[model samples]
Target: MNATAVTVFHRPPDAESFEAWLDWMGETAFAAEGFVECCRAVSDDPALEPGFSVTFRSEALVNEFLDSAARSRVLAEGEALGIQRKSSDLVIVEGELPPPGVGVFHHSVADGKAADFVAAEAELVTLSATFPGFEGVALFCRGDTGRWFSVLRFRTAQHLSDWMRSEQRAAALPALRAELTEDFSVVAHTTPFGSTLRTVDGRTRVTPTWKIAMLVLLVLYPTVMTLSRFLGPVLDENGAPPWLAMWLSQIVSVALMSYILSPAVAACFRRWLDPVDGAGWRISALGAAIVVVLYALTLLLFATVKWLHYWDYNR
Candidate 1:
């Protein structure tokens, strides 16, 4: 089967209406003949331009979709909604579908070791193909930056994880590390079927583990403690069983963490979470201090409330 990628740029007048239309277009594409998959992302760096990357089973189907009345009608609506079409292109891909889970590994190779790194990368690719779920590998390098990007496709997330944590990969780590200015980085975007990892705008935005852990603790501790202290008694008063009350509290805590707390914390710490190159220790230290202060305040507030309740009970 042939695959084609289409990229279109447009400026939408109304954000809500534009998103609604985009959703409709996605459903329409899914129903089209020879549809494979379509992925859309609003550019994080730019506010106005949104992008879509779609794949089809054949070039004929892609042309058919372009010529269809449905596409014309959508275009008309987009025009009425003040969406100006910037440009569109169809790229024909000459290969089979990539594996379900794809990862783009970005490596900053040491100077003068580009050839050595390429040789090692070839051996690594050969070694990776022996792994159970390996599908394909593609290598790329930017002439300006001298940085390397390798895209590896695997059958599933589990299979990808297995290869990542495998003993063979571990054995090759030492040699790989020697030729790198910094440790390699990975950026992954997940889909229903699997996941894809690609650099966005020539850079990967991976928050460090320590920063993530700090942010999670900052949100999680307060969420769990607030639910346990205040909502626990309410659940008991409503005749909930002990186990049921605990379960309910956990459910609420998880919901808040997933939907609200985590995103908010990440936004608040975005700069420190994704620091620029050569950033000093002061930024990291300040983030840690903020989390420590939050923890201290939470503890003090809970302690004061507990002591007041104890005094009232004794009286």
Candidate 2:
């Protein structure tokens, strides 16, 4: 299998049409070339413009699509839509599919010690690199949450187990354990599980980014409030709201949070659910993207539901 990296860049002069056009182009261009693992994402800073990046795999038999006449047409379509053509680049990279016996170690750290977890991870990476059949290491942590999550891909479980049992690896454990509030549990998976791998068109998108961001916020928000309440002095208390007011406030809060948070959540979905390559027929990236988009769309659905409920109750 040949792994190709495709990056399309466009600065939406207008935020209004940015999302619509992005989705349309992704569904058409990437999907046409069988590269559906795609995301049209913007940075959280709000100052930076947005861009789309996607990667897909092609076999020798059908690899002509990258250089075919259809490629020209797609380029033209993108230009007609005001997308900057020069910003796009397509190149083939050495794509690796994890061989069987790969184990993914997922860690969720305590309240405010994610940095310590990350420090430990760096050490683990340095130590593990010496092991045989170590394909690569990828670490993901959210800003809102203190917990750290990562996936380590290895050639075989035996390779990972051997590294895990090493004395050198053990020698570094003291520092990592000292930072942790409690012992971290490690899960060994000989195969990929959960919703981690999905293929779209012919491309595989990585897991989404938004989910990771939301997870962080989920941890950080409450932690901040708890700290403020316990560490700081509370001066005054307002009158408590009635039950109806409380429910209304909660609904409104949820709506606002989802609206502000949906983009990052979608990004996370795109990042994780992406495929390693186009080999099996288990699930497609289009299907996964659709699921992710729908999940984000649920925010609107919830808002509508609440609106209807409010109307009925008021009437």
Candidate 3:
């Protein structure tokens, strides 16, 4: 099942009491088996509803929690604590985020004008409402870094383009540009995807070439081992069990050689060829090459080991 997270925004009557209640709810909800994490943060203004974000692994789990008696009891306790339900909207989406890439854009502004940054980011944040399929904005400022990062998430490619092309937003850009110094105007994109796959951020790691190689190996490996097993019985050979020993030998050799040489070999090829520019092609080629090398190395290692076994037994 795909991972899912639900966010509920509600305005509470009492600010202090509402925050305390949210904290309690957060702790209580996390005790559930499917709960991955949750956060309760005040909205930008008291007028805006306070926000509660709950993360879970599956929709089924979320539904189970909502339908259970636990939810009823929790609602009762929350009501006693003065927490009331506000308007809620649910967004369901599934897609992988590109590697840890951050896009940066900057504009110059007048000196000693710091307040303009607020108006600037406010405009950017509004793109979610202004443009189609805009998800949200994460804006950050670092005095030490002397730079601002505004990360925008969108549900579709068209949504991203809408903000980029809006003439009204373009007109407002000058005011934003007026707030930065000479070196402030800049943009950068960085990709970070490796190891663990995340629901919001992680995408499929499998490539087409890798898929093909795996299919070939799946058939070839088992067939060869099965044939070897039958041949051993027909030849009346005795000692090690052919199928089990060969299968174990193949798996071990492949893993060992792959760990030792795959990355280095792939890097060498990348440097030498330098033909692939797109991420998809580069990744696909690397994956295919790695699988082929792994399979070939497995055969070499397993054959060497088997020959050694035969010679040792004969001696």
User: Could you tell me how far off, in angstroms, the CA of residue 51 lies in candidate 2 after the best superposition?
Assistant: 16
Please provide, for model 2 over 1-315, each residue's C-alpha lDDT reduced to its tens digit, 9 standing for 90 to 100: 434333434454656665676566555556555563544432222222245444355543135545556655655666666766323343433323333434333355666666566667677677777789775454543334544434454567677667666788778877776656655544211111122343222223444454344444543343333333332222113343455445545554455445544434434443333334322344444544555565566446545654433324423
Q: TM-score for each prediction?
A: 0.40, 0.30, 0.45
Predicted model with the maximum lDDT? 1
Q: Rank order by TM-score, top first?
A: 3, 1, 2
Give me candidate 1's TM-score against the actual structure.
0.40
The runs of at least 3 residues in candidate 3 whose Cα sits more than 4 Å from the true structure, single-residue gaps closed, are 1-4, 34-36, 45-49, 56-62, 76-123, 132-288, 301-315
| Cα lDDT computed for each candidate against the true fold | 0.64, 0.47, 0.48
Q: Count the backbone clashes (under 3 Å) in each candidate.
A: 0, 27, 10
Please report the TM-score between candidate 2 and the true structure. 0.30
What are the runs in model 2 whose C-alpha is more than 4 Å off?
A: 1-99, 188-315
lDDT of 3 by residue, 1-315 (tens): 333333443455677887777676667667767887564432553222355555467766766655667666866877776777643323222223322232223333345554566566565455435667655543443343445434444565455555566776667666566677753422211111112122211122222243433534634563455444444344335455666656655665455334533333433433222222223666656765766776787667657665433334433
Query: What is the clash tally of candidate 1?
Result: 0
lDDT of 1 by residue, 158-241 (tens): 677778878898788778778889988664332211112233323433445676777777788778877776787788779999
